[model samples]
Target: MRSPRRGNAFEQAEAAFKAATKKNEPMPKAPVTPPAGKEMVSLRLDRDVLAHFQDDGPGWQARINAALRAAAGLDPA
Candidate 1:
């Protein structure tokens, strides 16, 4: 007949089994917020539409934002 577990032996075996079965979880990352209150996004603009904005030079992005805001009837950014 097989010998039976006695006293702390069963407890020790249980602890070992629990330690081996425990999951190692990674720390969750904090959400990233934009410094200027604007969220960065990917916009797919048509080539001709993009070219029209780019023709104005360096401030094209700001111009596009202004045009969008005006079109939406929102105050200029």
Candidate 2:
């Protein structure tokens, strides 16, 4: 097999695991309301905050969401 094809297969497997785990987990029992279809909004945070997130690379947005959830007294995991 080609090298690129092998890399793609590994990526596909990783994605599959993520989806499977997400599906296997029990759903939160908060009356089933979710914040979907929300528009992307920009905010001006402090330089340190921005730097902290940028250093995390990809999925930084998800980290931000988790932080927001925690701030709102909601469970992030």
Top-TM-score structure, candidate number = 1
Residue pairs in steric clash, candidate 1? none
Give candidate 1 misplaced runs (Cα > 4 Å): 1-35
Which runs in model 2 stand beyond 4 Å of their true positions?
A: 1-35
lDDT of 2 by residue, 23-47 (tens): 5558678775536865578888899
lDDT of each residue in 18-37, candidate 1, tens digit only: 99999989789999776686
| All candidates: TM-score | 0.51, 0.46
Error of 2 at 48 (Å): 0.8
What CA RMSD would candidate 2 show?
A: 16.0
- Clash count, candidate 2: 0
Give candidate 2's TM-score. Answer: 0.46
